[model samples]
Target chain A: MENKLKRKMLWLDAWDIEEQEAWFSHMSLQGWKLIGISKWMAEFEKCEPQKVNYRCDVFKLNDKSENNRIEFYKQSGWEHIATRGFIQVFRDMKGDNSLEIHTDPIEQAATLSILKQDITKRGILTLLLSVITLMLIVGAHQIDPVGNYLNDKFIETIVLIIAYMSISITMVNGMIHMSKLMKRLKSGSLLEHEKSYHRKIKRNKVVGITVIFILSLWVLTVFLNLMNSLQEDRFPAIPKTELPIVQMADFIDDFTYIDEEGLSYFKENSSFLVPRQYQLEQMVEVPGETWEDNSDIYSPSISSFGYEVRSEWLAKKFVQDLKEKHTYYAENYVKVPESKFDELWLSQGNFNAAFIARKHNKVYRVLYYGKGSIDEIIERALAKAER
Target chain B: MANDQRAPMTEAMYYVLLALYNPLHGYAVMDEVKKVSNGRIIMGPGTLYGILKRMQQENFIVLDELDGRRKIYHITENGREALKHEHQRLTCMVDDGKPLLGNGDSNGK
Candidate 1:
């Protein structure tokens, strides 16, 4: 009486093409008629679930004889329901054997050989992609100074990995299952357990929940940011004058921003590229020079310029990463025993100091080298950061 | 796998050739073979198609007729000779087995 849509994880292997047929027939009979099939899920529409017989055959698609085959099946009283690539699904309206698609085990084996070949090709392609994607992730980690990702771009990195690996794993699973099915069929041990399909864990719900969870997290982050920006006293929007606050001129004395064309690429891949101001000759920096940039894309309302909100665990990692890659710096920074704030101040000389303080989960990184006391300079930078 | 020096044909292959002594298409060959072997030799579409193609390639069978989408094949002179040779080999084996099977429980002494 009404139309309804439902998604299901149809878990039938190569050996269970017959089971797939019977399963489809059962589905239609139960009124959950299959309307579409994708790589991951089967789409069904509700109607009057009537008793029917379904059959799936692996026919060579894009051949001249395909029409003849379809005609022959039509004459035999089977209605072609859908064509998924090479898989032809046909329904017997009366739930009777007007004709059989595969009549014998030998014929079934030949039919399965085609599927075996197709999946083998897919498996090889998936293996190549999985390896390449994994290598890229690892390679990205190596170039990244703070570890696997920038302190803020961690979610994006995880998403990239998951998207690639899910496809790879599905391809691999198909290849392996097809291989096992072919081996058993070839050996004449047709282990067709009648109800083995029912025991398979339905993962459609899990996939649905995961997608919802990720979307909700993204939405929550955006919503929180919107709320934060509206707070006048707390996390206010950045003023137009502060748009170019963190310029290359503050970090180095002579470097250009690699031209405007390359600037975007530079910011996106800053972890991999050093786009500092190159010293042409003797260099003089501007007074009150500080590099203040927030990398978090979700929150435009950065509460303070120098302070970065990160997972609490990353505070220790930030300091450790700095020490481990000390060879990249001009001078080694020794840890100060005592400090005015709950901060670890690492100083190269009396004039130069790096103040790292962890407040709750936020980390404040203050870099300075001047004639005035380090504490006073830190205070000045903090005041400007709040402003 | 060798030509001219043919290995003994399989049961399905042998009966298929026998069934195709008269010109017949795929389904007819399947039906005739089953009848001749008294329901023992059952051939499906895929198996018959595979066997017929292999036999045609080996020059053991030739396409006698191309009826619309159906193909009818007939055994060649080479095919008849191969079948006769296999029959003789099978008869010799059966004749050899008659003595051992006839004197039951003799314990080979």
Candidate 2:
């Protein structure tokens, strides 16, 4: 005879002893006898449809007397089916009159003490992890809130927070259920067998599916990041044109675009929160300019980064962020109230002049290293942004 | 004071101790406990195992030998002392109750 097997993914709390036993019994009645069990799955073999009793007991797996204990149960006519962590499942036919594994409720509660202690330890560890995750998020925001928003780290942080909170919630929920089970057993009530598990199964299904969905989302985010890193063009062969970013030619006349190795390039990237990002680093020089004439090798270089955000509000905030970032090099940023763009802030520095501007749903920053009025650079940047 | 931790022995623990008087293995202890209790206390394998392990930890019992996978245990002196005290305590309680309940034979009717 050919033996058939089936596997099921189940999410039953270990402390929910009655529900686990009842569920196994229910499966047996449906002609699927449990053959194996692990943390997240149960393996079943096809058998004749018959009523049977399933019982779960907790015993330390590493105990020296574990084999003796199992042998004792077998002598009493209970067949050990599977062991998952400290939990051991046993089965017997309904009318066999086999000795119950735990006749005394209080004694059974003694066996559950080990499980309770294990859960308490896990609960404490999980709580610590959750607190650390929360602190990381708060620290990241406190250090550079605006920078995180602009660099697309805000979404990743939110996802990490959700993942930790979900795990914490699940752990706390399991602790609560275990406490209830312990209370009942301590009160000398035998754990009910063959109870209805429909509600518990439904609830577990929802929780399991939600956990899987969150895990998949996190994995997808990480995979996409890896792929983007591999596909990013670090050094372009030729200069890109028609880009919606400020270029050196827009501000300088009769300048040669510097195509030096590893000095200048155009790059693009995107994220879920903000799509359509562009970074440009272009160095330009006059026809007669040379390093001998000017100590600086790369003169009149334009390094600009821009983003076409999904909303005007985001662009407004991004412009402020750009200004704050540039304030490190330039002592202060003076607002250009009557600019061609929606908003603009020009850096107040002699060596490296910069301007941050926003128009509708677009935000950009341009840094110039030359001896020219920053107003011309700002005007050209605004013109390009408006176009 | 040495037996303070095991001063108040549970019914199951007391019966298990009594069963270990003859150096019985795990399953044999369960059978003996049921027989000595006149079939009133059908000790489950789980309960028997827990009591045996705890007794061994408290030095109330010692593993005498290992017959295949069966562990035969014998009661220690500490176990005997605890059982003796528990028996005295139970006897005192029954004696005290006899005055109010007519020796537990009149059925209070």
Candidate 3:
């Protein structure tokens, strides 16, 4: 008959040797005998339900005397089952008169020194990684706080911080627990092999499930946002419904919407920080208008971005960022005092004019490359923001 | 400095060195130690392995032969000298204790 096999995730830490031994023995009584072990899992084979004694020992890896050690244990009636890292598992019949792996507590403590050093090294590595992660997070925010918030990268940053913190905390907790176990062993106390592990197992299971759930949710949200962006139609006809943005029709009369390649489109997006955002780019030509009575057409263009932010403070910051960004190329932006909006700035270059305005929790920026007055465009934008 | 490092041998190390005097395999050494200590010192396989490895590193023991997976070991001259020193220290301790304890009789009680 074919052997039936089963696999189980190992939630216990490597230093929890006694708890592991007891758990393995309990599984054996339920007819599952351990056959293989790894860093994350244990594989078992079906067997008759019988009492068995399981033991775990730490041994140095890559030792030339490893085979001799195994042979000696075999001679002592204990069968070696598996090894994960420095920890080895062995078993024997419960009724058999087999000697324990470490009869002297002090000698057992000597064996644990290797594992203790390993944990200390891992703790240091975890700390280093955590510091790097924190620095990256802070640097991202410091570079461009408004851009980071607007692009919805703050969600990814928060998730990464939480994940790193969870892993670092777990590593530190494991290190401390291992140190306590070493101290007990050094004090000449024998490790108890039948201690109950149900409470710890249950608590770890809950925490593990919660972390997995949160990660899955984050992945799903990112995937859905990617799908939405990919499915957006480019250069579609202008909708008849009123939009929360300034359009070319609002400023020009009898202007025809240009439906050619790379000309006109509308995009809508929402994020946790800004619930509603709209972008519009349109190119229009006045009927029967030419630059110099030649084949060349006088096509004027406008690009407008509007955002309904979460709070008035964010709107103020968004408008300030917009003004700062345009000031680099358009020279100094002059504030339009006593405007209809709460705050406004007008920037003009040789051929193009732009304005950024904010009122309450709404902010909008418009760039017009046409033969139109900048004050007129600002009036239309304020009208849209008021609605 | 070397003498200081090798002066105080643990009980497990002393027993293991004594058992290796006859060029015994790993299991045989453990059995010999238990027999010599009269069931008072039960050396676990892990303890014995660690001691053997350390002693070999210190040049206190040498591998005599290899029979498949079984390795036979023998104590070296350095091992003998260290064991003799440890025995003398133990004897001194016992002599000092005997004067006060009265030869392990009911003197303290």
Q: Model 1: per-residue lDDT, tens digit, B1-109?
A: 1233668787768888889888886567768988989988666444565567668778999975475777678899999988888888777777677776763355355
For A318-387, candidate 3 gives per-residue lDDT tens digits of 7777677667655467898889899888778765888888889998888888767878888888888877
Backbone collision tally, model 3 = 0
Flag regions of model 2 displaced more than 4 Å.
A93-95, A137-151, A237-242, A288-299, A329-331, A336-342, A385-387, B1-6, B20-23, B66-73, B107-109
**Model 3 segments more than 4 A misplaced:** A60-62, A94-98, A288-299, A320-335, B1-5, B66-70, B106-108
Quantify how close model 1 is to the true structure by its C-alpha RMSD in Å: 10.0
Number of the top lDDT candidate: 3
Taking all chains together, the TM-score of candidate 1 against the true structure is 0.66
TM-score of chain B of 2: 0.87
Worst 10 residues of 1 chain A by lDDT: A274-283
Q: Which candidate is the best by TM-score?
A: 3
Candidate 2 lDDT over A1-387, as tens digits, reads: 248999998767776788889999899899999999977899999998878888998987678766577777877778889988889999874435458889888888888988988888898899998999799887977567555655567766776787788788878887887788889988979888877778878887897788678778878977987897798767764354567787776766677666678667888877654688888887776776555446655467778888888889877877776667557644477887797788877775666777788889888788777777778777777777778
- Winner on DockQ between 1 and 3 is 3
* lDDT-based ranking: 3, 2, 1
Please give, as one word, the docking class of candidate 1: acceptable
Each prediction's DockQ against the real complex: 0.26, 0.67, 0.67
